[model samples]
Target: MKQSNFTTWFKSGSPWVWMNAGAVAIAVIMTLGLLILIAVRGLSHFWPADIVEAEYTIPGQPAITLLGEVTTREQVPTERLQGAGLPVDPEQNEFMDRELLKVGNRDLYGADFRWIVADWLSNERYPEDVIAIERREWGNFYGYLLSVSHDGEVVAEGEQAIDALQAAVERASGIYDEIHSLETGAIGKINTELERLRLRERGYELDNALTADRQAELEAERAVQNARYAELESELVDLYREFNRDSIMTRAMDGQEKRISLSAIVRVFQPNAMGITDKIGHYFAKLWEFVSDEPREANTEGGVFPAIFGTVLMVLLMSIIVTPFGVLAAVYLREYAKQGFVTRTIRIAVNNLAGVPSIVYGVFGLGFFIYFLGGNIDQLFFREALPSPTLGTGGMLWASLTLALLTVPVVIVATEEGLTRIPRSLREGSLALGATKAETLWKVILPMSSPAMMTGLILAVARAAGEVAPLMLVGVVKLAPTLPLNANYPYLHLDQKFMHLGFHIYDVGFQSPNVEAARPLVYATALLLVGVIASLNFAAVAIRNHLREKYKALEN
Candidate 1:
């Protein structure tokens, strides 16, 4: 009966054991898969592709060199050849071309080429011409011409000069019309009056009543009219001079030359040799540049360095603000304070604070921090920085304080756990050695709990680093022109609004209309954040382990 009972019990328990093991195995597999996927996708962004050349000919036009795959004329469809306007004998084209080429698999015409089209013609009727060729077979007779031409300039200054000259001519035409109108109206009127006066004088002479006074008056009027005509003539001459085509063309050409020169300089400065690897390298380089450089207009290129600097500075400030208060609260509650209704209530409050919605904290931060504390600070300490509203507005210092408040519970809980784990006998032993309670707590208890304190700090840092909602209300901006730390009069200005990576991810992912382009960046940033937090946690754990080992003997 005992042997039967034992068998039954083993059978019942064995299934449960297998089930638990299976569950663990599945979890392990899933974790490995997730990690592998992340690494593969992230690192694949840096792979490079081979560059190739190909030739294409349009009938009646010179062969064009394209950088990509090469293909044989025979392999290319007759319709495609016809579309290119190449004369192909429909009956013999296939067989004759195939025999003439005698293309082998190893031949250049048969080789594959990779190319990106720099230019393509677009028309609905001939849609094939407009399509970009990513790859092509190189064995064709035309395939050899696709190599990059050393003489091909990306932009032609001569063409730009012609464009500018055309613009200038158009402008001059408008001015010419104005000048012509003035000349016709004023000068034509003067000429007509002169003719009328001459006619009147002829009549007077015929009547034989032409007096000296009349002649003098007529001469004076003629002289005045002639002066007006001369003035109009001079103005027209000036307008013609101003609108001179040669001068306008010369200026336009000069301006275009200068612009092209600057553009060439910029291009020269840019690294032009691009491969997949090179492109990925450039992306990271640019990201670093953005983080390190000063902020500029969104359309311009500059470093987002100010935002990065501000974010780091603000988080550090928050750590400074939260660490001492949280640790002290935790120490008092776990060690010094008696377990009572007040202590229980305080613990409840701390837990509740952790659960409160972050957005609610943001609202509270905006109202209480920006308006109440900032207003008071502005009135007291930052009166000189008024009108700019240094302390009486959203800023880095207030943002840090708000975030610190939000993460206080995380630090408190971690620190309290660290404190609770300290053996009571350690305190008793310290007292037996004639050490005072305060001294025992400081020297023995605090030292042993150092790892827990570090753990708390790490947790707090992680929470602060990722908190975006509170930052939005407190001081985080889409862009910050200057860093929080600078050589300006008072270094480390706390009143500046700053940019943060978490906020940046939010802005780029949600706020931006271009989701496709920003999506990759969002993933990259998220990966970076996770890496940073993981590294911090690992470091803290290492320290904790070392401390635990050091205190292992005392635990007994």
Candidate 2:
């Protein structure tokens, strides 16, 4: 009767236990799966290749090849280009000297061949001048055409008119400056007089007849000063009229330069949806150029290689910082320290710190590390760099230190758990064999617990890799032209600001004026970061399983 009762009770509790276990397993699996998806999507944005044509013609200049083949605008109908949805600026045609043509839509302006010609008068006066052009297309192109020339009479008249206008502006500016200086002096005198009047009013409290007649004379002088100041202000306004006088007068001097209409040029190269696809291909090609070349401007054909290098370097530095400190703390707490009130209190403090918001850490790091410790270090070791701030500033080293602090608890918790799982007999046996405590820990305890140590490191790394808030206050920048590591003197300067992937995503998404276009890139970068963390975790797990299997016989 007793055996039957025990069997019934065990069966009833089994279902509940199995249900809880299954739910936990499912949750873990789903989390890992999400991470893998994000990583895959992000890495794919850098891959893919495509092509499109860029076309433009000079004003009053027939399109002729170096080989002497004349291609009239009439021969190539604007409809061919329009069907392709090529970009055309009617305003550019109305105001500028030369017609402009680009490979694709203006919104996709960064991905193609962009051309512009300054108006005729400015063109000759600044002979080496080149109009701003952008090639914001995806793929490579086979052919490019540009015509540059101007009629002699139109060019000469435009140049003469611009010169006359510039002379007039210079003369007006001189007059404006003189009047402005005089007005400023007059205003200052008026203010002085007003202050005197105020002091005189205070004197009235002591005496009734204190300079009443003198005060009236000063007020009259102040009114005259005010009138002169207004006159000068009016003269300054008239100076602006001289600024655009050249352009306006030139238009009246010579009819607007004879130019091919950009709209007419677009009608020549138009393509269908196939053309759009082709242009997207060209866009990718242009993007590749940017990725492979050195940086030119903030927005230009250049690679993000420096940023990538800086991000990886910073993360690696942070890992180096966090790992040893975290692992040591965990080892001490789990193996050496007794479970007393103080130890328990310390553990609670660590857990609470882990839950504290990241931004708070940023502020703390900025104040304590950058201002205090760095300032002290500079004062002691770098006395020559006094007041210039050796350590009292943001840089790669401080950033790493800040992130290390943020990730310490994560590593400590992971390591402590791993240490707890080692059977107590292993330590007892080492001691029985006459091995010293230090030797036992170095030879057996650490080696045995290494897989768990690695697991903790992996978890810490995953968290640190994506952290942005603390980094912002420490040293991460939106754009870093050169990486922290370089072939210059002091190859690795810890004081320099570095770029990071998480910060890059924020910059491209929120800071860019072209947010709509940058959206895809943001998604791609996010995916890459997720993938990197997931891959590291997977490797750690693999190592853990291998260690478990290798130690199986010893456990027995």
Model 2, C-alpha of 552: deviation from truth (Å): 4.0
lDDT of each: 0.60, 0.58
Q: After superposition, how far is residue 461 of candidate 1 from its true place, in Å?
A: 1.7
TM-score of 2: 0.56
Candidate 2, which segments miss by more than 4 Å at Cα?
A: 1-144, 147-302, 538-550
Q: For candidate 1, lDDT tens digit of each residue in 1-556?
A: 9999889978889878988999999999998787666655543332322223334444456654443222222344455545555565556544222211111111233232322221221121211111121111211121111111111332212334334333444565567567756755567567768866776675567668789988998899999999998888898887776654322111110122101111111001012235456667755755565445453323122344555566567767887999899989998998889999999999999999989988888899899989998898877765444555768888888888888888899889988998888888888999999999899988998888877887887888788878888888889998775567754435677888888878876876787543433444555555555665576567767887898788877766
Q: Estimate each model's TM-score.
A: 0.57, 0.56
- Per-residue CA lDDT of model 2 for 65-139, tens digit only, reads 111011111222344433445344454443323332223233223433333332211211111111112222332
Candidate 1 error regions (>4 Å): 1-304
* Candidate 1 root-mean-square deviation in Å: 22.4
Question: Once model 2 is optimally superposed onto the true structure by TM-score, how far is the C-alpha of residue 107 displaced, in angstroms?
Answer: 11
